[model samples]
Target: MNTPIDLRSDTVTLPTRAMREAMYHAELGDDVYGEDPTVNALEAQAAAMLGHEAALFVVSGTMGNLVAILTHCGRGDEAIMGDECHTFHYEVGGAAALGGVPIRTVPNGHDGLPALADIEAAIRPDDIHDPPTRLLCLENTHNRCGGTAIGPEPFRAACDLAHRHGVAVHLDGARIFNAAIARGCPVRELVAPADTVMFCLSKGLGAPVGSLLAGPADFITRARKNRKMVGGAMRQVGVLAAAGLVALDQMVDRLAEDHEHAQLLAHGLAAIPGVHIDPSRVHTNIVIFEVTDPLAFLQRLQAEGVLGVYFGGQMVRLVTHYGITRADIEATLVTVRQALRAA
Candidate 1:
């Protein structure tokens, strides 16, 4: 039987051969004691790439975001984010449940950014009644927004708005490398406006596991403690960091291939009957489209060995990743068209 074309997410990607080799031979020490050479190297590389003083290696993107949030906000403080952001819809509300930080939501435009005015209005006043807005969270290549890349200018504007109000900005930049590749800009330029950033190595980068939370050295020092509180501290975890290092070195530039495949997928999906999508809005590897009967459509696609996830309501999401090729994308388009007809 042929291998199924899995488009559910980039998280399903397997590590490269180089990544496996590196993981096997990785130098190890107790990471909790700050003695893991490989883990230390991964963290330092991530910080330098994001233009931050330091970074903390965490098990997943969710944990990285949670650690950053915990470091930035105190109990009863609030965080402002886009209504369509991954942190608002996903991440399981860890910020509120564990850190006592409330999330305030503002409208996200098609371009994947909350309007500056909307963010300004959401800030809590000095009054004792309302929770102070302590953090502004942003997502690049925003998931729900069809992986739209947030460029530097608007990103900087939003960060400046939050900063003027004394609110720290934390970016959920899980697919930031994708955004940078799509916009033809450096990754650091995209994240420079934010106070902290959490990026996933497991997603488009194709590492088996790990995410990094980068920020000021003091913030990372506190985040390391919070990581322990959340059971994210691991001993001798350089094995995982080794894969992340290989991902950083080998997987970043090739994100352009995934972006190209996504554009191809989006345009192909647009041509299909009973499918709704704006190919122009697809900026990275994520492709979101709506069908008349989402359940029936997805079921048919699965039966045909084309896998995609049903996103809320009538929407479905597919992602292009390291292992997916143009041939696979072409086959997926054919399968989707057939599935829609059958549905």
Candidate 2:
């Protein structure tokens, strides 16, 4: 096995033996007919946990988000989301390309929630020229904002603003468990303000595949059809759902440890020369820091078997997941100092 200590993202985590065992024993049926008992159970579990009336299993966070956008907006309708959101920056503009939903971006606050004024101003009136603002999206533990978790004040403000304008709010809660663990709240508390939410089983939860989109039963039915249209309809999906079952049950609480490890890494990095970070804002598994010449920095770190991604310019992100240990993080911290010294 390689000791490279890849911290590029939490998505690299492999399913645990326990999760694989569950997958091996899962009783499967054709999910296209909605008869897969294991998949049904996983959807039900996700719906209950997120305080939603129903849930649908999709192949990835990107798929879940695209389906939600398609279900909420008609052709030429607009989706109001943060400029820093994954849907806008990444995800290949699928909503606009395939669903015909235009993107209207708002700047994100430091905590990763959209500025309420910008969102309110962006809502189109009942005019013929403007694309109707059909939906507002929120990304909890907002990825580009150094994994800043959404708080009640900002989340409530955004949800209330969108709902007051008769627009639905959908949460891109890909790593919501990380946010909930740090805030000492249940996942529902963070996601309840939104009309719909999607969380990943594969990312930090250590499952091989699958994401759950939770919403009202009627909305979920539409999302399921949209999912099928986009090649997300799997027949014997219970194999993946079984691992997600274990992920939901056994992986939710353990996220606190990952957060702890991230905080330690952030603090340790800040102590090193040429590294800049604010450890106070690291409330989850992601620690994004800045160093001079990040491209050169990453290359030097790579020689020592440390791997992470450069987030444009001098910024880089390191994510701690179940696959990384305390010893690994400590070694990573030591390696960072060496990399800086060598720079």
lDDT of 1 by residue, 1-343 (tens): 5889999999999999999999999999999999999999999999999999999999999999999999999999999999998888888999999999999999999899988999999999999899988999999989999899989999999999999999999999999999999888899998999999999999999999999999999999999999999999999999999999999999999999999999999999999989999999899999999999998888998888899999998999999998999999999999998988776
Clashes of 1: 0
- Cα deviation at 109, candidate 2, in Å, is 1.2
Give TM-scores for every candidate, taking all chains together and pairing residue i with residue i.
Answer: 0.99, 0.98
Q: Model 1 Cα RMSD, Å?
A: 0.8
lDDT of 2: 0.92
RMSD of 2: 0.9
CA lDDT of every candidate: 0.94, 0.92
- Candidate 2 minimal-lDDT segment of 10 residues: 148-157
Best by lDDT: 1
Q: State in Å the error of residue 266, model 2.
A: 0.6
Q: Candidate 1 regions off by >4 Å? A: none
What is the TM-score (0 to 1) of candidate 2?
Answer: 0.98
